[model samples]
Target: MRTPVDDFQPGFAGRRSSVAGRNVTILFLSALTIMAGATISPALPAIEAYFADTPEAAILTRLVLTVPALFIAFCAPFAGLLADRYGRRKVAIVAILLYGVAGVSGVFADSLFTLLAGRALLGVAVAGVMTVATALVGDYFSGPARDRFMGQQAAFIGIGGIFFLTGGGLLAEFNWRAPFLVYAVAFALVPAILAFITDVHRPEALPKQEDRGLISGFFLTIPLAAVLLASVLNSLTFYLMPTQLPFHLKALGTNSPVLVGVAIGACTLASALFSFFYGHVRRRLDVSAVFALGFGFLAGGLALVAAAGSFAAILPASFLVGSGLGLIMPNLGSAAMAIAGEDNRGRVAGLLTASIFLGQFVSPLVSQPIAERTGYAAVFGLGAATLLMAALVALGLAGLRSRRQPA
Candidate 1:
């Protein structure tokens, strides 16, 4: 079975030494996508208070954390299309520049609306960064190498989340705007991206009728739909930590932003640790079984969150949630990439990225009103129940697959 890497071997034959640098650069770029939303999560309450005079300040302030997701969801497919038509490196460079400018623009905004506008642009930038970066992983590697890189990529993003979330929390203690300064780090990565990242050359286009049929068929496949749906659900539930946990903690008598950061960082720390071992885990379990295991952890974690009485209790809960995410992240990427040919890898990656953020964007929208009416515990409880059901469905699918296989 010839892999994507085999096709490019001659071109890369002399560039073996550069592979490490390329992988590192792509991993660094992956961090930026998660940073788009999670970094400022601790500042939500402060932003809400600062904008008390604004209409619907409570909802809008939460949107400040999630609004970029909305834009990323809407714009990611377009970004992917551009990357597929043009080239990944050029799109990535431009996106990284936009990310820096848009990210920092929040620090200067005097109004909630302006801050959200900046966040929306940040989403557009994230769409480009995330889509191309994932596509590059598919372009550069195949088989076990791709699987290993996906795990490493997820682990790196989790590690980045710990730093940004903790740093943002501490900064929020000083001023809500302080966390926005973290966006400036995107600028530093531009030089590395230019030096190390190279775009893959796409094969010649198929005939128009055949191309359209193949692309349409791929999009409509059951496996692809399942992966996309699972990605959306996984993100929607995982996002509850950042969007709702701080307020939940405050309601439980923990009001410090630093503590809030630490609580959220616990989740990222656990995620990083578990993701570091994802390749080993994947070697033993099929993707459906992995999903079952991951969602089970999430179900257990959210249940703990709903029952917690103190801030300390949230740490263990966060760790459980992170473990689930650690597995699910790589599984989603690997599954989607497995189905993607080089011609549409960018579009597939873009769609998957969009689904993940779409869930993030929708998380607050779905959870907040429920929390407002039923309280935070009820919201977490309902999420736990939903995830539990998902876990069972995945287990059943795994069982069905096994039964169909020959002894």
Candidate 2:
């Protein structure tokens, strides 16, 4: 073996060596990040009821969520910088443990302010975990291998969402505290992380400080921008479907929580199935085509909901939308990373993660006010139009990308 004099710096982000153990560690981190999101959603109604002082006060609980999403959007790039600087393992450990501690504190929160504080803290931690984990994946794998694993991440996260939603739903029926306790899992995972994940960085992982800032101006290409915008739209569609759709159904005189859960759950399940076949589908279809199809599905699904008089109709419509969403994510991520290059992969992925959260933040806030002003259908119309715009942009990007490439 070469001596230490070989000056090998195959740290975590570096391509020094491949180890399955490291991958497992990364996947674990992803699970916690997803779980953080999963757990909060089901308990939203309970949270509102707990703070039933005013509609305005109740909205603060939502801030717990929207704040995290927004913060993740703002802070993801910075987190990546720290990960690449200090070391992936160290960064992940500290951030993850913080996420767990703050996240679990929600269970004991006695007031709205306390809960909000916990959620806000959790958001900062989530930014770190999400950006670093994705960056690590980029460093660890390339090409088909990376594609497959991201698909796996997509599918598995879908599965996790189901568990969180279903379990949180059930718990909300009993007491809201049930879901907040899910953060205990994060705390448990920390020891495993410390034991398994190595703090290595690849030599070519990210450019030096002098070069890093300059790359973003060039790397954030037109195609990549379209995908980021699409990511935001995708999140907008997701949030609109749940929060607004239920209100729409209520206007029709239906309030079956079970039915609502079933609709959203069906949509997520459909997305999971689409994620499973992401690779085969990607090989046969272009990325723009794949994303456009998803956008089409979302548009159709929303339009159907807009016209839906019966809850029975909402289920199939949601599935269609989910299929479209599921198809878009794996392709969007793969395409983004492909164009982003290794140097800015973490920051790019961070941007992607932020877009998703920001989209979620905007969806309900935007759609609800529209619904209140006009009607349920009006909100859906907005979602459909937004999705259609995204589809158009994706197609245009495809054309520009094709013309720019050389033979």
For residues 1-407, write the lDDT of model 1, one tens digit per residue. Answer: 87665665545434766777888999999999879877899999899988999989988989999999999998888887777777888899999999999999999998998999999999999999999988988988787778888999999999999999999998999999999999999999988887777666453443444333224655646998999999999989888999999999999999999999999999998888888899999888899999999999999999999999999899999999999999999999999999887677888888999999999999999999999999999999999999999999999999999999999
Report backbone clashes per prediction: 0, 8
lDDT of 2 at 338: 76
Displacement of the residue 147 alpha carbon in candidate 1, Å: 1.4
**Residues 153-254, candidate 2, lDDT per residue (tens digit)?**
677667776777677667666777877887877877677676656543543444565245523455677878878888887987767765666556666776
- Largest lDDT belongs to which candidate? 1
Off by over 4 Å in 1: 9-16, 203-218
How well does each candidate superpose onto the true structure, as a TM-score? 0.96, 0.86
RMSD of 2: 4.3
Candidate 2: what lDDT? 0.72
Model 1's alpha-carbon lDDT is 0.89
